[model samples]
Target chain A: MSVKHALLALLEQEPMYGYQLRAEFEQRTGTTWPLNVGQVYTTLSRLERDGLAQGGGEDTEGHVIYRITDAGRDEVATWFTTPVARTQPPRDELAIKLALAVTVPGVDVATVIQQQRSATMAALQDYTRLKRQATGTARAELAWSLVLDSLVFAAEAEVRWLDHCEARLRRAAAELDVQNSRLTDGTSSVKREFRRSTGETHADRTRR
Target chain B: MTAVLQLTDVVRVHGEAPHEVQALRGVSFAAYAGELVAVMGPSGSGKSTLLTIAGGLDQPTSGAVTVEGVDLARLGQPERARMRRTSIGYVFQGFNLIPALTAAENVALPRELDGVAPRQARAEARQALEEVGIPHLADRFPDDMSGGQQQRVAIARAVVAERRLILADEPTGALDTETGEEILRLLRARCDAGAAGVLVTHEARHAAWADRVVFLRDGVVVDETGADRAETLTEPAAR
Candidate 1:
């Protein structure tokens, strides 16, 4: 999740050309983090300027390669062992929905989940149609194809997960019990059943 | 209390036909080992229904329920009755200590009801008082002590039998904030002692002390998780 550290970590493995590094970054972690050769060069340039890394001159093709310095090694070691706590931006979309759901008559949580699920499913259908239309035989086309597959799979999974979530929420919503025990006999119920076996009446079983 | 004994989906309906009101629909929540869970909801939201059903003081209108893994709904009426007597310790909103009994005697009542030897019950009651940090109040009557002290005595009483499940329906509702916190501390200690408990509270402050907080509405649990689901759990509950 930490992009800077992840790049630095990859660079520590061995000397790599900017293009090679970019490609490897994607191949390794399913790089949702977009990696560009220019970004790799900029980072390597910064690392060389900081003395935490150095350019290994150039290959016969004139592409510069990078190697880590002692300081860079220490930074990568620290990065690997020390966890960076994730700070997600506060998102209260669900909470807002729940709060509003309570205010509207007949708009319980089951209906809410159902509505969300429907929209997500619709989006999945759209994504599937788009995926089917994407074609061609270029490298970019292959990459686009993979991205489309990921998108469609993720959407379908979200729709399925939402369905399961809604079912569980509905099951929980259906089981709210209320406590009220009083009858014409004035015996009350619940505890009265316990009191009855001993022939105790309401007056006799009155708790202090 | 340490952990929840068990709970099943509990639903209850009031009245009949179109006039019928569903108190609880299908509420199911659990208190964990050494966990002090608080169930909070506005009036008419089935808070009491959850505590009572889970405590086995009443059967759910429909659904399975278990206390300490013993199914309350499946047991014969008499066995379920005995389970209530032996496995559950209840502290109601009312102090409800016997007017004539001293604090120690009130604390010992559960054991006495179970036919525990009087001397043994007295010793156990004194120890429970000490556990709740109020052994000095053993001789005092409920009226003699402050409301806070009375609740401590109530907690001592509730745990005297070492019931695995201590179901307190608004145990501190009648007390002021300071006293309420002291009572919460005592309940926390009970959980440390390996008794799992459920505390019903309207106050968010009280509910946050629980390892988990369960929010109910319309006789159902709407949200439940660590007291702080989106933020740090250490943030204290607002009074």
Candidate 2:
């Protein structure tokens, strides 16, 4: 996801104008992650400022081409070798919403979970459709297909998470109901034995 | 534009009233020729029941089930059996191939039961096997073939005789990921070749191969995705 590193890597291959860089990036990712021409130029300028690349020479069409420097080649090599840092995790809206849904009073958590599952399934279906359309024999097409597969995998994982959340919610609600009934029934031997042995009050049990 | 399989307000109930369990509650669905529709839901959400009802293997407690313009409820047992052998084909998670018969023989059984001559049936089965990309395995027994090969044979049998409606229950469930994908590709190819396919699956990735996805909850249709809607989902932004 590091655009600067991506641009440098493409430059490491060969000199490319802004338009060619954008096109190459989009082609490799199937345009699932479309690069703006301006953004490409901005990254190229930043790379030049950092002495990793030099913008010089002109292609046949009079477009300025960027070439990777020795520093840029080393940067690309390091990028490939280093594991991507995950210390700063990206914000996950779904996880945050689910957390609030569980804690917020009067929220319809089940409906929220179902809605997300449906949406994720729809996205997963679209990725699959795109994948089917991609013949993937060529190198660029195969790269695009891999990008689509990543999206499909992430969407499928989201759906499974939603299903897990729903099940846990249902189980928690059922357990609460059982505890409520036991509290109201003085003759319930399970509750009586638990109170006698652990001395855990109903409030403590509810919190647990 | 005609539907190969249609279920109109279908319902199925189990046991007597005191303990009756409603498996499908007025579920209506249709799969047209050249289309593959995926049915997805949690276990016991009536996905399997819907496939069974569509295939005419189980009777709906109410509502009409139609296949290729024929009302399944109106057919007698013998007539329905004939319909099963001719108009419909079923693929299951398990290959369900006859252990004793070779691949070709197993695929040819349905055609032969429909009264096609033995020679013609075997020929047709070979063609079906070819369509599934396993013509060379025609003489191999199920025990000798890999799981993927057995699944291919199962698909060949389902698609033999150019069955108009194909009902598959988790057809890729028993195979590895790559093998499962190959199986789905075969199913998609068959649907593209004018067979209407109904795939019941819990795996979203498997269901994604279908043209449309229908979700069930507690025996009721809860959500359905449209083809147009699939087009509207935005791609992830460039990082």
Candidate 3:
């Protein structure tokens, strides 16, 4: 859906051949979201069928040049003004995996967290390195840098969440131990003591 | 590649038996010349402890700490103090600039103490100020400058006399986002110029400036993403 919209938006700029449009898209986005030339042609055909684009003219190289119609311009304007719908969020495999890891017995949750953290951290580093190499201040470079920055921030959040998960797990294990000891001792006094000592809730600790 | 700062299986314990806390437990780390390494962890994860020991501000309870091949554990207090002045530079989150001294004077103080002539130290300070992009503020006192400018002065002081190993502990904590980025840029530039840098920070955005990241947990290294991995990263497709 986005690729179609993105191609439409790019077409709003000027008439372009399939390869040229693909190149422009990749250049602006630093190839982070590479587009196949075939996909570009397919989207262009759909736009033509919808009366939003016309592709009758041929370039010197025999490449069909697709131009946006007035209808296409209107569609692009609507796309710009409208916010992306988030009612049905995309599936996040990492979050799902983490949820499962915590619930499933015999799973080394700490190791899972650590491994994911390292991989995400490595991804963060890669993004940083790419950002460093993208030193140009041109509009295209700015677009690429912003894309890389988004990736870097997302990876950082994932790492921080992993750390928080580890700490929460540790706290839960400690509380479980206290509860187990209380059960063995057959006394309610230790529960009172534990609560008094750890009077601070997770919210309080997070605030700190 | 020679490590400008190396910590070999270092351990540090605070206080005696009953109330003692192990701050660093057998943690080995190295920051090579021309490389910036960021240390990240939750609070009380020995991030600061590792930095202090690396800077020779605090001694490791056991194991070796070598700065430019000089074993800190074998040195006397006076010699180690001299090493801190000559080889290691520390930048704290607070900026820690002396209010009475001008920017150049604050930077020159360490060099002057190390027995550099007054005029020469002053000249070196000016050069360092220029390096941190604050040459025009050389005569301004800490009280007169903005927090960002004061932090620039703090960085100038750290890199003055070409200290081989620069240690920063949340150096941008007091500044705004843009200023923090400028400070990180300065630090990254210093490391790129062949000075080894160890940055202790919790913010991964800040750590992204480093060539590698070392994550600490419970006084031990839990994970590391090294520069080698960074180097092999695939570049974006050609424009």
Task: Report the alpha-carbon TM-score of model 1 versus the true structure.
Answer: 0.52
Error of 2 at A83 (Å): 1.5
Q: Summarize candidate 1's per-residue lDDT along A161-180 as a digit string, tens digits.
A: 55466556656555532222
Best by lDDT: 2
DockQ of each: 0.01, 0.52, 0.48
Considering TM-score, where higher is better, how would the candidates rank from best to worst? 3, 2, 1
Best by TM-score: 3
Off by over 4 Å in 3: A185-208, B227-239
What lDDT, from 0 to 1, does candidate 2 have? Answer: 0.90
Ranking by lDDT, best first? 2, 3, 1
TM-score of each prediction: 0.52, 0.89, 0.91
Report per-prediction Cα RMSD to one decimal: 18.8, 7.2, 6.8
Question: Per-residue alpha-carbon lDDT of model 2 for A1-208, expressed as tens digits?
Answer: 7999989998888899999999999999977778898999899899999999999999788999999999999999999999999999899999999999999999999999888887888889789989889975999898899888889889998888898898899989999999887778665787578787997777886899
Interface C-alpha RMSD per candidate, 1 decimal = 16.5, 1.0, 1.3
Task: Give the per-residue lDDT of model 3 (tens digit) for B1-239.
Answer: 45788899999999999799999999998888888999999899999999989988889999899999999988999999999999888899999999999999999999999999999999999999999999999999999999999999999999998998999999999999879988998999998998999999998878878888898988999888764733333232452
Q: How accurate locally, in lDDT, is each candidate?
A: 0.73, 0.90, 0.89
